[model samples]
Target: MLTIVKGPYLQWPTEDSMTIMWETSEQASSRADVLMAERIHSGYQGNYKKPEHVVSTVSNKGYCTIHQLTVKNLEPSTIYFYNIYSACEKGEIESGPHPLKTAVRKGEPFSFTVTSETGGYSGFDQSNGRINRNIFHQMQRYRPDLTLFVGDLVNDGQNYDDWEKYFFRPGKDFIINTPFYSCLGNHERNASWYYDFFAYDPPKNYYSFDYGDVHFICLDSTDFIKPEHYPNSAGEISSGNAQYDFLVQDLEATSAAWKIVFFHYPPYISGGYQVEELRKLSPVLEQYGVDVVFNSHTIVYERSHPIRGGQIDENDGIVYIVAGGAGAMPDWFLPKREWHTSQSLAVPHFVQVVVTSNLLELRAIDEEGRLFDALKIRKGTNGRKEFL
Candidate 1:
């Protein structure tokens, strides 16, 4: 049988186009037809204005099993419908007329889901699996435009079977439609699977993207996790290198209305794995006016008061959040750190962020569908912020 093993997921959507990728069990030629939506619908429907198709076929000696197709030349802030067709020996396999919205306009409002350290393989519990299901259903209801998965997607990211069971299979509800942009976690351990499975905007481990008047920096924290041979030495932003330099320059050059950064490690967090040296990022974030920082690894939900230069600065400090409770194990606070205004390991959870020109709204919800915490960040002209 010709089976799609994973994906039909989307990647970053630009003003004029977007990418849709998938993999099948056997080698095959694939094609996808893009159709613009004449009118908005509450759900996916076959009401497309016309069908625009893009096709790909295997060459001479090789059979291609993976497909990444880009649907191009569409209007900004508009939605489109598309279906995938793969030609194989048995028959033509077809899927969807799924709905996808193009990139929002400059000042438009957009929202996305964020979470990390989803439960790994440590002590797989039957009950914990149910928690993961509940959390995913909650996310599905929200229908986030995209999902920012910080790290530790699976307990063992390198093993295909592990991902298939825990991450991909369990997340099928939302993964099919919501494009997941993820960073590396220590547990990934420099696995090639992480790179092969997902597509990056800049096609690098570390990169940035701009959406809806917001500039987002997705950094790699797994660089130094492996001591013997560090796979991502460039992420050692302390010393001058491409990753570090890119981060500095990118933050400096961005004139977006809001700036946010996310990764697997928190520069400022309280836990056994806490590495003080990661604090190197604080000065830079403060210098360039980063509004918030998101991280996951410690398996808890934590939110710090806006901090600048390692000190609580309500007027200008960047708020740091640790939201790693998808399915992985849970952890407790190391101590009552001065920076922590709220901390919880009561349940597994994820964070949802919505941004517009003047405000950034954050809501943390646990697996049981309870609101853990919330913050409303209001911005003034350019550099000013009206703290709440």
Candidate 2:
């Protein structure tokens, strides 16, 4: 029937370009009709702008069921509407005049949501599937410019069906408009599908990008999650491999006003699961002045105090957050709180971060869409922060 089997979703946005990707039931050629708007009317009473036509570049060989089309020369910080069409034996089928926005320029304001661990495979009520819809819709309410998935997208990385059921299907609406960047988690099992589905820059599994004045780095921390792995033995940074070298270079090169890093396993947590090896990344992160780090895999929500050298340094230390509460079964916080824990909670939640010129605000909201924790960091001379 040449139906779309997946996404007419957005990804890897740039100030001058936006990439739209989708998969069709049959091998086909694709095209899109785009409309740029100064302002779009909220409902059916339509008021819009002229439409622009764009063609898709077939991304895969053979049938060409997958299509990735990058629309270029777009105006920075502008809103646009687009609809995709696929051609095949069943004639042509069309989808969405979906809305999207190009990246904002440096020093401009923007917001993004952070989440992960939606791969739970238990029964609907017991697994992440139960609340994923609610949480995703909650995220959509914030209308974030981007979404950061810290990892563990599915329970079994190799299981094709799980990706569809656990993530893509539930998050379709939110992801279609809000582009997302992701890392890997142990549950992903280092599978090929993870690479095929997400369209990121080269060396896909680990890469970095800039938005406004914030530098965002996504690293691969899955290896260290192995039960037997210990410090200096495994992990993206601790293994002393390409990823480690890349981390150093990436951090050194960026002069962004704020730096945020994302991975899977928690190096610091008050939860049951903790990977000792991931802690090896602290020195490097602090040395390069990373402002904050986000992680998932513990299935709980936690925020660490500004930590430096294993101690809290409110004036100039790095803040670590575990925002693994997407759709996984909630885990309890250990009764014995750790010294570095600033806040700990057992709930399925999402984090929203708003970044302006010198101020960053973070709010953690639960599945029911209620705020539970809030943090604000005001940047000062030489990148020092005054947290409130």
Candidate 3:
């Protein structure tokens, strides 16, 4: 029997392109049939139109179990429905008629969800698998156009089973429709599987993308990992490294209205795990006008007061959010509140960020979809930000 072992999921979405990938039980060739649509669901399920031709990949060794296809020539900020088919020796297998929307143009409105530290073992008494399951369910309700995963998707990136049980199986329904971008976490162990499964632009580990008016960057934070765990992975985000150069060049080039960066280790946190070395990048982040930074590792929810030059500067400082409660074992806030902490809690939750030309709103919701915190920022003349 022919079977789809994994995926039928989305990735690396651009205004005019979206990549669809899947794994089959046998070596096979694949095809994607796409149809452009106006609305998300037009009360029409049975309608079908001739599809635009898709671009797919076949293994260099004739045929392979994995199938990947990039659907192109799409219209920006438009809706499209697609179906995937895989052909093997036995017969043809089909899935979808699924809906996906292309990236919205600059100054347009869009939303994305954020989650991190989702890769811990359930039995570790640190993180619960049930919470991961519930959080994913809640994430789908928001219908985010994109998902920004801070890091640690599996307990052991080298262990294949961990990927399926800890990450994929729990996130299947949510991931299929929502394309996500992730950074590397310590728990990933710098394994080969991490690189093989995802697609990115050059220097894959640290990359950036744009949606609407927001410029989103995901950095590897390689300094956090021990040498033995990542023997051959030498990428670093320090001031003198290549990753640093990319950050400078990319930040200087983009003209997006809002800038957000994320990674696994925190430069500033209310907890004990803060990486003092990472403080060196703060100047660069501030210089480039990064609005917010998301970090994970410690399992706690923390949003620091906007800080500039090591002090709270509400008028112009960048906000740092530690959204580490996705599915990791909980970590406690320090015995004494830190000067930078605006709000700190140890709860499993996810954040939804809605961005527009002049405004951005963020809401943090727990597993049950109850909002715990909300923030709104309005931009005025001269790119000045007023936080409400």
Q: Against the true structure, whose TM-score is highest?
A: 2
Give the runs in model 1 whose Cα sits over 4 Å from its true position: 38-62, 119-124, 228-235, 328-331, 343-345
The C-alpha local distance difference test score for the whole of candidate 3 amounts to: 0.79
Q: Compared with the true structure, what per-residue lDDT tens digits does model 2 show for residues 122-189?
A: 33246436678888999999999999988877878898888888788999999889999989887788
Model 3 residue 375 CA deviation (Å) reads 1.1
Scored by lDDT, the top model is 2
Q: Where is model 3 poorest over a 10-residue stretch in terms of lDDT? A: 53-62
Q: Go through the candidates in order and give each one's C-alpha lDDT.
A: 0.74, 0.82, 0.79
User: What is the total number of backbone clashes in candidate 3?
Assistant: 1
Candidate 3: tens digits of C-alpha lDDT, residues 60-94: 23456666678887888877777878877876688
Candidate 2 accuracy as TM-score: 0.92
